[model samples]
Target: MAKNPDIKAIITTDKDLVINSGVPVFLSKNLEHLQVLCESLERILDASSHEINDETVIIVAR
Candidate 1:
């Protein structure tokens, strides 16, 4: 998979704690560029999001 130059950051969390974060970069033409960006973001989140354990509980504050 290609990286995305425009993506600043990808954040992931579990049990109110950050589990992972990443930034991706890649070079591509117009349409491919956008696709890469979107794909990168998806990969970032997918790579970061993890299954929780019985002792873990995710919490968020608005």
Candidate 2:
């Protein structure tokens, strides 16, 4: 038996939290990007309106 097992722990103090796992990231530095994302998100939400009935969290990046 191994004395110690390999494990990973994540800790953060950032108000904006994100987790990275080789996934692509979209970063916003200005209102333009935010606006574009909002519009796109609205379209997606509208398309999937029936699937969402509660407050949701949409994380964009880490």
Candidate 3:
């Protein structure tokens, strides 16, 4: 019933593919870049980031 706290963004180093969801997706050059992007995005979007793997991270408010 609520999507406010749901996925707000996505960060991935993989440039080959991405989902078609409405969430904003950020592409990074490498793992380190991904982490740095995640940190900046987390603060900017006021959400927490979760690493789905070494190449991917999902951002959510809760």
Candidate 4:
């Protein structure tokens, strides 16, 4: 059986902009760090990463 894709976590440089939620949020030092974190977590979390904007990325399980 297949499972529905669901948002697993969110990564952002500006933690203040993202609201508190059930999803885990990771705050990075800057854009570079955010990208790196997103890539690493995408693999570690076994999920795909998506760019919400310049400063935000979200991870979703496939």
TM-score (all chains, Cα) for each model: 0.26, 0.32, 0.82, 0.85
lDDT of 4 by residue, 5-60 (tens): 69999999996967778898999999999989999999998999989989999999
lDDT for 57 (candidate 3) = 95
Residue lDDT tens for model 1, 31-59: 44444454565555443222134322212
Candidate 3: residue pairs that collide: none
Candidates in order have lDDT scores of 0.36, 0.35, 0.86, 0.90
Who wins the lDDT comparison?
Answer: 4
TM-score of 2: 0.32
How do the residues 1-62 of candidate 3 rate in per-residue lDDT, one tens digit apiece? 85555888889988775767798888899888998999998998888998898899999985
- Candidate 4, overall lDDT? 0.90
Model 2 whole-model lDDT (C-alpha atoms): 0.35
Ranking by lDDT: 4, 3, 1, 2
Q: Which one wins by lDDT: 1 or 2?
A: 1
In Å, residue 42's CA in model 1 sits off its true spot by 0.2
The residue-by-residue lDDT of candidate 2 on 1-62, one tens digit each, is 74542212212223254457343233444445544554565464342111111222232321
Rank list by TM-score: 4, 3, 2, 1
Residue 40 displacement (Å), model 4: 0.9
